[model samples]
Target: MVRKTLISNKAFGFLFLFIFLLLPSFISAQTQEYKDYTVEKGDTLWDISQKELNDYFLWPKIWKENPEIKNPDRIYPKQKIRIPLYLLQKEIPETKPKPELETKPEIVKEKPVEKIIEPVKKEYLVNKDILIAIGYIADSVHSVGKITDSPVDRTILGKDDYAYIKTDNPVKIGEKFYIIRSVEKVIHPESGRKLGYLIEILGIAEVVNQENDDVKTIITDSYDEIPTGSLLDNFYEIEPPLAFENPRKPDINGYIVATRQLHIINGTWDIVYIDKGKKDGLQVGDILAPTLQSKHKIINGLIQLINLRESTSTAIVRKCNNSITKGDGITSVK
Candidate 1:
């Protein structure tokens, strides 16, 4: 004979109440329906999301619901995945019977109000003017116009100097463009990837007059001596940051490929170029530190990204006990 355990009336009442409360959620889960999809050749989760969910960015949602998917990028043929229809499709409105209203006496209770403390924006070490001069590397810069010649017989141009810009594109009066020089291309030391080109900001120019294919402009702001044949593009607005924004990938790391001024040895306040850029989720106001195993650990310091491009970023050494060298690996601190 099977032995039976006796329960008290009070214990049975608690168990009944718990089961009564959880019964609705259990029933609701059973009613929830999920559409199934089979992975086919040449089909990516992103493409599948767009076809099924009507949004490409919602692929993560589909990936989350399916635990078997080992990798988001790699889904083999004949693999089955479930789509959460509640997230994919919109809800249909339903009408229900309204409850009858009953009048009741009002009662007021005094409660403590909770307060949320906001973080204050901290000013960055460098200002806009300094940032403009400390230009970052980019994959490519689309030059809209190029300086052809100047009214004065001079090799280099400066502020208040009038120059003729040649371009097939249309020009507008009072329109402004950044005067820049394409220095050279930078390559990743370890990855061997073409990071981008080094672009130096020379100055700013404003369109004054247009004659056929030539647009006459006056140099507005001169950071460095502008030269003939310098390319003109839209000006970038750089501002001093409050506190450093949290790194998109907290553990993201990259190499310090090069240093500013091509120094044989680098120290604090020196500008360094990182291989990682916007593609790697790096952004302005991000703080980076030399990895523990990186060379010159005694001189390792923190670097703050001042500017970013598609393939690279320019950072300033904000803090360090010693110094950093090219090829030293750096990781996000915040």
Candidate 2:
């Protein structure tokens, strides 16, 4: 009975020792599956989350993986840390992330990962209100209505004046038309090519009375003189939703064709028209650098494209080194 008891005690001791010896190796083997990282100077969990996953909000998940990190905010240099790949599948924006782990973790035998792609974002430049108000160049003018005559026999129209309008198209009672006039025909200075007519927005008119094709409209607002022979177009007020500031450098070039105020010399806050436009990979919010040809390229100022057409763009001078003119050479810039 004594020998049997002694044999039983020996077997139990061996079993306990075996488990104790294998425990550390089993834990280490499991940990080895994940890549290891050592904390460095100026390292914060918040920064780590963004640097690793492109999301600063995921710091708590990273902290949960590192149980030894008693205080997430109090990490030290050379401190060994385990920042495991927590999610098998994650949706994140495609960004260049700098991971503390120098190498890509070969953490196979785990759940598979799925990465989703999202659209890239752009920088906002100007107010849409100001953008829509800026005049743009067009190849042709299509007027839905025309100002045939005015009440009280007024030759020159101003604000709050009644005008008789006629259109072949259907006109509603509340429909609005923009009183615009062809100010001048734009001719390319260098090439001597006829670009288009510059349609100036004089005022806004709203239809109040309509009898068959004869429509009566009241000039709601006027910026310039609205003559009797002025043309009426559909009211345009929407700006581009994707119009953003240009972040890329100059790859395409164009020339200034006209100015918004018809100024011979344009300065800050002046809107100018450019020859390069949407067809030339130009878009709203693109920054253009106006340069002067000399012994060296002279950068006069910068312009931000507020409107883009097929072959023309309207840009507001954001910066003015000297003065931008009608024929200044332009190149796209950040």
Highest lDDT against the true fold, candidate: 1
The candidate scoring highest on TM-score is 2
Where model 1 places Cα greater than 4 Å from the true spot, the runs are: 1-125, 212-214, 244-249, 261-269, 279-283, 291-299, 320-323, 332-334
What is the per-residue lDDT of model 2 for residues 1-334, given as tens digits with 9 covering 90 to 100?
9999999999999999999999999998687665566777867665676676665445666666777765454678898766664431266446785677577778679787898886653222444434444556778886877888997898899889999987758888989988777767888868989899777677789999977666789988776677898888888676444432124454777788887643211111477888887788876656678887555778886776767788888887756677677877887553
Candidate 1 at 322: error in angstroms? 5.2
Model 2, runs deviating above 4 Å:
1-133, 212-214, 240-246, 262-268, 293-295
lDDT by residue (203-246, candidate 1, tens digit) is: 88999998777788999888777889999888656676543323
TM-score of each: 0.54, 0.55
| Reference-based lDDT, each prediction | 0.72, 0.71
Error of 1 at 138 (Å): 1.9
Per the 3 Å backbone cut-off, how many clashing residue pairs does candidate 2 have? 2
Global lDDT of model 1: 0.72
Q: lDDT (0-100) at residue 154 of candidate 2?
A: 88
